[model samples]
Target: MSTTVTQQPQHSTLGECKRWLRVSLYTIFLLTGQCTATLLGRFYFDKGGKSKWIATSVQSAGFPILIPLLFYSSKSTNHDSSKIKRKRSVMFTLYLGFGLMMIAMDFLYSCGLSYLPLSTFALVCATQLAFNGVATYFLNSQKFTALTLNAIVVLTMSVILIALNTESEDSKDLPKEKLLIGFFCALAASATFALHHSLLQLYFVKVAETGAFSALVRLNFYPMFIATVGGVVGLLGSGDWRSMGKEMKEFEYGRVSYVMTLVWTAATWQIACIGMLGLIFEVSSLFSVVVGNLELTIAPILGVFVFHDKIYGVKIVAFLLAIWGFLSYIYQHYLDDRMANQDKSDDGLQVSKGEEQI
Candidate 1:
């Protein structure tokens, strides 16, 4: 009995360590993949690549890369046939709807990136946290705590600061109309992205019956496949497909560079999506978005160095405000974790006391 008791604690500790390790790994993937993908995406526009349809397509067309991982995971695990049978049709419909939403979100993102400077674009994307908080409140029944509300308000202020400072270096060269379009597109994209996260979380909580990894793969694969098809249709229908060859040849760095840029953009975005889905499966969607905001911080700094984007005072202040907002959200998580641990400890003590009394 003593040995069993000792082994139980060891097992629990090991499990906790594994969970933390997985979370850490996913976070790394999210940060690096997202940052690199964002830069490459900007590079595509900077170097004369066009076709928003193509950009949107690449975001999900790389779904094929998840195939091997899906196969391996499937072979390694046993799924309940009854559950799979019950959920297959429902899952398919959900993925189809999600794929359509992804198409809209990715297209808006492409539009935003096309017209906005990379740094400005990244900062605008930071509003996803605020949007996610609101979406989760409605869709996931997430409570609006003080810190969450503060984060939202601060983040909104950051965006407003950016909006007010239109004469900044990044927007001076561009037409005001285009800048407005980019800003609104980015804001809409952030809201759609938040809604996507909330919907995915709802699916996981109420519908998913498989392992986290398996569900992650399926959620990505089907939606991406559908989105890729939709992107191709849009590309051809818009007559942009004909310009692909010219675009590649006219690219400043040559055809090889253009091709490589799109490929890597696709690859890195897929990696980031995998990381994001893993996090959503393992934690809350809001937690996944919080970790993703790390990219918002890093992307702007990288933008200044790589693109030589000018740093205006307003942008700097806005950046600081965004960071403050993220930190506020993170602290709320830390407090929640402490409270949970305390509750667990209390339960353990109660059980021990009951055992002693018996």
Candidate 2:
């Protein structure tokens, strides 16, 4: 479902520059989130402490961000409350659906991480951008121009190159079936995540009439709360609640490290969500995911240092291609903005000339 809002255009170059600045800052947040998440995955899954509850709890990282949002929302007038209520009334179903989707995504991502090696997982994660871009194009009616399409193609090729000689370190000792299961589960998770990005954008465009903070709050808060509940329920129902102690003991680090890892994971993920949501708000969902995918580029280098994951010449070439693709995407957006500003200036000049004639 889509809702339409007649949005005001930001024609001022200052506004564009500010948007870029904000996006850049937010991109850093997303990058931080990706880096931490990569490390946490290596830490948790490699050690076999795969807690579904932790998977869902990690998303609760955004709860702190939600705190400020709640405060900000409270400062608004009663009229704002009424507006929020009306919008919430319409979005009740979407919220519930997406809340459930969030739960599924968290579970899928956990399973994927548990089953795959970090390098292979990173490469597979790149596909989330492709899934997101396609979804935004169709579901959110976000148009991809020729230049942007070229960028997309380059990014796709980069992933292909990265995966061409891929072998999962974790899969070597495991059965062939586990590898296949991990590959497919990771793919499913990526696709489902893409849907989440697009759907959030749809809601942002149509139903989120408040400030960006409030919109972000709504996006993370409800879904996260539901996901946390789901995790708790799943843990209790599956009797995993009783196994928490054993899982912690099994962690490479002691139980304290296990506790610390989960807390760190939760905090970092929250930080990343802020960056992701901010990017989506400042730019587009496709843009945010594209930036988020830079984690793929960084993760391999990190893997080399931390996990001793092997890297080859082919992977280096793939990394360069990914960089080129990222630059191409940014350049296209710059060109679009330049042309837009030029047209606006020309229109202003024409109006001035008409005034003189008058």
- Whole-model lDDT values for every prediction: 0.82, 0.74
Query: Candidate 1, residue 169: CA error in Å?
Result: 1.8
The numbered model that scores best in TM-score is 1
TM-score of 1: 0.87
Q: What is the C-alpha RMSD of each candidate to the true structure, in Å?
A: 3.0, 5.4
Error of 2 at 58 (Å): 2.4
Task: Give per-residue CA lDDT, model 1, range 1-358, as digits (tens).
Answer: 3454445555656776687688779878888899999899889987998888988898988888888988987987788899778878888899899999999999999889888875577668878987898888888888778997887777667666665564354553689899899999998999999999999999999987777888888888899999999999989999989999999989999999999999999999899998998888777788788778756655656777998876678768877887898789768866776586567656666676677788
> Any idea how many clashes model 2 has?
0
